[model samples]
Target: MNRSFPPLFLFLLLIGCARNSEPTTVATETADDDWWKESIVYQIYPRSFQDTDGDGIGDLNGIIERLDYIESLGVTAVWLNPIYSSPNDDNGYDISDYRNIMTDFGTMADFDRMLAGMHERDIKLIMDVVVNHSSDEHEWFVQSKSSRDNPYRDYYHWWPAEKGDPPYRYSLFDAEGNAWKYDSTTDAYYLHYFSQKQPDLNWSNPKLRQEVYDIMTFWAEKGVDGFRLDAFQFAAKDTTYPEFPGLTDTTFIDYYAMQDGLHDYLREMNEQIFSKYGVMSVAEGAGRNFEDAHALVDADRQELNMAYAFDGVDVPKYGGYALTTMKEVFSRWDAEFAEDGWLSIFLSNHDQARMVSRWGNDSPEFRAPSTKLLNTFLLSMRGTPYAYYGDEIGMTNIDFDEIEDYQDIAARNGYTKARAQGKDMEQFMRELNFLSRDNGRTPMQWTEGPQAGFTTGTPWLPVNDNHAQINVAAQEDDPNSILNHFRQMTRLRQDHPVLVHGSYELLLPDHEELYAYTREWEGVRMLVVMNFSDEGVTVDLPELENAEVVIDNYESLSRTGSSADLNPWQAVILSL
Candidate 1:
C-alpha cells in the first residue's frame, strides 16, 4: 500500500490566495520575472533517480511515475541534469546533440510523458543546457575536424601554436600542457577547457552564438519551462589568446571567456528569446563571487534569474579528508549573498559527495540527528532549496574496493593521478572513495528491496550498502524521519512567503554553535534557530520574547520563559 500525507490543509490555506489570485500589475520584461524565482526546485540526477525500464538507469518514464513523490515535497519545479544524447563522457556533460534525448535515458516519447506528468501536477521542468562546449563527436565538431576549409571549422576555437611558444593552457591537464590538441585530419589545434573530448565552442563566431540561441528556442518551444545553463562563464574566450602569467617556461593562454561583451550577448538572448517564452534561466558559475552573483540574478541585469553559488558548499577539505564545521561554512554564506540577488542553496549534487557521509556523521548512531540538523540548516536559509535524490533518506557514500568499480571520469582520473604519484593504493582509494562524485551518484534508495527499489536490474552505479536500513519505505511512516522533516520544512516555506523571499538577518553572528537568523518581510517576523553542536546549549532570547514557537525539531518546546534551551542538534522556528 502506498503511504504519504497530503500537506496539512492549514498550510495550503496560507498559500492558496497568493497562488490562486491573479496579479494586479504586469511586471517589466526581464529574465528575473520568470515564475522560477517563486518556485522550490528539486534537483534530480536522472541516472540515479529511478529506473522504470529495468535497464539499470533512471529514465524519463521513471520520473513520470514518481511525480507524486516530488509533489509531496511541495516543490514546484524540477531541475534535471542533462538527458540529452551524449557519449557519457563527464556523465552527459559532453552533449553530442542539442535536440535528442539519449537512448539510454529513453526516447523522446518518454521525455514528453515526463513533462506531461509534471505539468499535470503543476510542476515545471528545467533542463540542463551545456553551451560552453559540445562533445568532440558532435556533428559540428566532426565536420570542423574533417578539414580546415569545412564551414564548421570556425564553429570551435582554433589557434596555431607560435613557433617558439607552448600551446594554450587547458584547466583539465597538469604540468602546463597545451589546451589545444592537433588533429591529423585537420592539421589544426582545437581548444578544450575541460576534457579534450569536449571541444569549446567559439562564441566569437556569430553563427555559433546564434546556433545556441536557436537551440534554446527549440527547447523552449517544446514546452520546457527553462534551462539551467552549464559552464555559462566559459562560453567565450579571448580572441587574441594572450599568454597568462605565473606558469614558468610555458605559454599559458588566459581564456577571457567571461569578458565585457558577454553580458550583451546574454542580454540579447534573454530579451529576444527567453523573455518571449517567459522561460527561467539559471547559469552555473562555479567560480563566481558575490559581485558576479548579483549581476547574474539582479532584476535589472536581464542575464539570468539566478546562478548556483558554491561559496560555502566548496569549503576547503578539512584535515585534507573530513568536512569542516557547518558553522564556518554557513556563516560565510550568510554574509556573502545576503544583500540583493538570490542564491540556489544546496548541500549535495550529482557532482559532489553526499552530505550525510561528507559532512554529517553517517554511522547509525549519529545519522538520524545529523541528517535532521543539516536539513534544518539548509532549508531555513534564504534561497531556493535543491534537494538531491536520496538526501532526504540520509544516504551514505559508496564504498568500492576497486578503482574499476567507479564510473565518474573525474574520480577515475584522480585515482590514476594518485597511482602515478606512487601513493598507497589503499589510503588513496579510501580518500577517493569518500570524495568522489560516485558518492552522490549512487542510485536512490526507494525501499528495502532488491536494487533498493530503484531498478529491477543491477544499477549502472552501485547502490549504497545500507539501503535496507535507510530506504524511503522505512521512513515513510515515521513522522520524525528525515523525509518527513523535509516535507515539513518545505511546507513551512510554502506557507510563509517571508521564509521564501524575505530579507535575511544573521542574529548573534558570532555564536559558534548556533546558526540563528531572522527572515523579516513587511511587519511579519520569523526566526530560525539551529544548534549545530553535539552538546546541549542555552542562549538568551530577549529579542524573541514576543515570538511564539511555530515549529520545533522535538515534540515539546520550552515556552515558560523568555530564553530558549535547546537539546543537542535541535532546531526551531518561532514567529512574531
Candidate 2:
C-alpha cells in the first residue's frame, strides 16, 4: 500500500489584478493556471548551441536542427540568448536592432521557421530581451550621438560635458573606468553600467519606454511565448546623476539599478505589452534582495512572472559556501513567494562556470554522480529550473591554459584589472580558468571528430579536449549515462505533481557533508538526500524505512533496514 505524508506548509501566491498607481483596467487574458509553475526551462547560448551553416557560429537553423534533441530532454520552454543583430563585442548582448535577426544567425524568415518548428513540437520559445542597453552601432544610438538637438537624444542617458565628469558611477564590466562614456561629437557622456559599446537606455524618456514596449509586442505578436530580460535590474537609472555615497557598508560605486520607482517602470511595461499578450516573463534579478524580488514578480504587481537571483550561480569568491546556503536560498523564497511572486533555480548559465565543475566534484570518478546530485536538487525544488546547454552530459569546465584561449569580454577585462592590481599572472590565470564565463561559452561537443562534430570548419572557441570521451553521441545509447539520467529525472518531474507544487523542508541542515530535504504536497511526501563530499554517508529515516526508491544516481539503492548507505557523491529520491 502507498504511504501518505501530511502537508507541512499550506501557502499559495495570491493572484491579483494588474497594478498601477493610476486608474486602469487590467488585461483580460490572464491564465487560470500558472503554466510556469510546472515548466522546465533550457537556456541556449546561440553562438555555441549548434552551427548548421558551418560559419564557425551557431545560427537559428542550427537550433531548429536540434529541436528534437531539446524536446528529448522533456523541456517545455527554451530561453535563447540574444540573437538580434550585434557587433559581437559581448557575444550578442549588445543589440544593434531589436526587430531583425542577426545576419550571421540567419534572416528574419529563418526565425519564423524556427519558431514554427518549436511550436510544432509543443516547445515554447522565450527570446532574450536586452533593453537595459543597446549596441553602440544601433541606429538609435548612432542618431542620438550625432547632434545635441537630435530627437533620439533622450533615448539614452547623456550628461553635458560642460558639467564636468558625471558622478562616480559603477561599471560591472569595465572595472577601471566610469560607467559614463564620453562622446566627442555630441560633447556629452552617456551612461553604460556595462561595456561602453553597450549604452543604457533612458527609462525616464516616455518615448524610449514605448519603443521597448513596441519591440516586445512585435515579438509577442509573432508567437514568442515569453522573454528573459537580460540585465533587467539595470534598466532604470537615477537620471539625477547623484554622487555615489562611499559608505563603509556600501563599498562599490553604484548610482544606478538600485534606484527607486524601478517597479513603476516594470508595471508600465507589463500593462503595455506583457500582460496584454498573457506571456511569461523573467528578469535577471542581480543585486536584489528577497523583498525586492517579491516586489518585481508578485502577481499583484503585474510585473514579471519570475526572475533569476544569482545567489546559486554566483558562488562566493573566498569559497566554502555550505549546502545550508542553498537551503536558505530556496526556503526563503518559498516563504516570501508564499502569497505572491516566483523564483527560478539554476546552477549554470552562459555567464557562469559549469554546474558540476563549480558546485559538484568534476573529477572523472565523481563527475556523473555529482552531476545527477545537482540535477536532483534542481528539479525537485519548488520553482522553475533551468538547464544550461551541455550540462546534461556532465560536461566539465575546460582549463583554457592561457588568456589567449578565452573569448569572453568579461574575462579579458578581468585579466586587465588583475594585472594592474599587481596580482600574480599565473595565479590569476588559474582563477580565470575556474571562474571565467568563457568556461561555459565553449563550443558544444556533439560527437568525437576533428572538431567534436560541432562544425566542419574551425570552431569560434576551442572545444574541450575531453569531448572525445564525453560527447552526446557516446551517452545517447547508454541507459546508465548522465544524459539518460537527466532524461529520467526530467520525466519524473513531469510525472510527479509533488515536484512541481510541493512545499520544501530542509533536513539535516547542519550536516557537513550531507544535504537532505523533504517535499510534501497534500498528503504525499518525497525525500531527497544528497552527499556533497566524496565520502560515504549512512543515514536512517524511519519514515522512509519502507518507502519506494523512485530515483537513484547509481541506478540502484542499497537499503538495509531503516538505514541506507549512500556511496561517494550519491543522491537518492524516496517516495513515502
Best by lDDT: 2
The residue-by-residue lDDT of candidate 2 on 1-576, one tens digit each, is: 011111100111111222212111122222554787678998899888888887888899899889999999999899999999999899999999999999989999999999999999888888999998999999999999999999999999999999888887766677474678888997899988788899998888989989999999999999999888887776777778767753211233133444676788889988887888878888875344656677788778788898677654543342345666555555555655544567798878887777788778788898889898989888887789999999998888888887788888877876787788799998777667777787788888899887788887888988889899888999999998889889999999999877877766767666777778777776778998888878888888775688888999996778887888889888899998
Candidate 1 lDDT over residue span 46-148, tens digit each:
9999898899999888888889998988788999999999998888999999899999899998888889889999999988999888999899999998877
| Cand. 2 Cα-lDDT | 0.78
| Stretches of model 2 off by over 4 angstroms after superposition | 1-33, 246-255, 316-319
Q: What are the root-mean-square deviations of the candidates from the true structure over C-alphas? A: 8.3, 7.3
Model 1 deviation from the true structure expressed as Cα RMSD, one decimal place: 8.3
The TM-score values for the models, in the order shown, are 0.88, 0.92
